[model samples]
Target chain A: MNITLAQARQVVAGALAAGRAASYKPLTVVVLDSGGHVVAVEREDGASTKRFEIAHAKAHGAVALGLGSRALMARAEQQPYFIAAVTQTVGALVPVPGGVLVRDADGGLLGAVGVTGDTSDHDELAALAGIEAAGLVGQPD
Target chain B: MNITLAQARQVVAGALAAGRAASYKPLTVVVLDSGGHVVAVEREDGASTKRFEIAHAKAHGAVALGLGSRALMARAEQQPYFIAAVTQTVGALVPVPGGVLVRDADGGLLGAVGVTGDTSDHDELAALAGIEAAGLVGQPD
Candidate 1:
């Protein structure tokens, strides 16, 4: 199922709020629809200049692969060269821990959310929190 | 000036509606901030898979240079080497007719809008309509 535009904004809002509430470093968040196209993106005022691109790359990686970046990392351990090849050739993804897939109740992917500008674990925490706040299921790594 | 997420979405909504009202081909629209980062993008159902990238490239080109793609095209005629250098080095822009800059009433640059999946003229028309609908100005090329 495709994610609505409203849902995409909600994910950004949720993720950013989580970052703020936790007093994490400033962040940038991105939401992508099922087709791996960006739906929405936002960068906090204090976020690093590179935050948005990193967030976008993470979200793209998640949606393009139909799996969370965490899962991809595990897979990458088994095939590092393949992951490297995909990133180098396509320039479409950055398999990392900050990307999370959003799914419908039936486990059908709706899209993905990505967070950047913090530790990988913190970024993942924010993304997962956003998914839950939006009442969407986030698949476990 | 900056384009708010709400304004970005309104532009997409307006452009897509204009496409439908005119019975144009399915389209994909993208909005980018002055920083050349995407604010939002949407591909209408039935749009070609390639439309999103085209739209994004168009928008990126517009904002990066602070000129509409039409203007860029004209400049490209005189400076093909410059355009080639930019494409090869940055890999972020596609200077072409469907991209337009968005501005505030004071002519402050906000960002840009790009549309794809139709003739370039039609794509530009839709982008202008969207800019007007969002209460912003579109700098005509």
Candidate 2:
């Protein structure tokens, strides 16, 4: 399944909203389709220039491996070699939290959402909230 | 040693033939010379968009490291950090089973082949088959 640009934009908005509510730092969010192609991305004011890459990579890795970044983080710890090789294979992969897989009600993969700027846990919370705002499911593990 | 244009074409043909014979998914093939320059590439219909980059990286890594991707996979298991560092330095390396180095009769390096679309084992099989069709030896270990 593919994520519509409108939905991606909504996800971004929701993430930003959640960030603001939590008084988190400036955030960057990236949404990518199942093919790992970016659909929408945004960097809030004060976010570093590298935030985009970091966000995109987190989302890209989630879609590329069909697993959330949180799961990847666990795998990275248990099997560092496999995760490292996969990071190279996928071109960009950050084995950390904040990269969540977006799914439909049927559990079908739609896309991925990546959030950066705040702590990894906060980023992940924002991403999940965003996915919820889009009426979608967020799989962080 | 150099792999001639004709030989490269032959390799592509053989790889495609093998894929078709096995009724595998649409495939992408990349042939690279010893210097890691692309000599030939083909993407079958319905292949995913990222197949080219994935295939190229596999082949490029094989030739760049002077070892088949399968061997790289093993090395990655033993030395995760080292492999990750090398991947970063090389800029493109996928330590997977689809990359195979091509060699001449006297064990002189000719080039490398990368295949994607099916399982990694199947991809490597196609690459080896292609090398053989070109009358070259395949070093996949």
TM-score of chain A of each: 0.93, 0.97
lDDT of 2 by residue, A25-75 (tens): 999999999888899999999998899999998898887666789988997
> Which ranges of candidate 1 are over 4 A from the true structure?
A1-27, A33-35, A39-47, A63-66, A72-86, A89-92, A117-119, A129-135, B75-86, B89-92
Per-candidate total of colliding backbone pairs = 0, 0
TM-score of chain A of 2: 0.97
* TM-score between predicted and true chain B, model 2: 0.97
Q: Report model 2's interface C-alpha RMSD after superposition on the true interface residues.
A: 3.0
Question: Which 10-residue window of candidate 2 chain A scores lowest in summed lDDT?
Answer: A81-90
- In the range B79-138, model 2's lDDT, one tens digit per residue, is 867778998898677777899999999999999999988888999999999999888999
The sequence of per-residue lDDT tens digits that candidate 1 reaches over residues B104-139 is: 999999889999888988999999999999999998
lDDT of 2 at A92: 84
- Poorest stretch of ten by lDDT in candidate 2 chain B: B45-54
* Global CA lDDT computed for model 1: 0.82
lDDT of 1 by residue, A46-138 (tens): 465567678878888887777888888887899999999888876767677999989988988888888888898899999998888888988
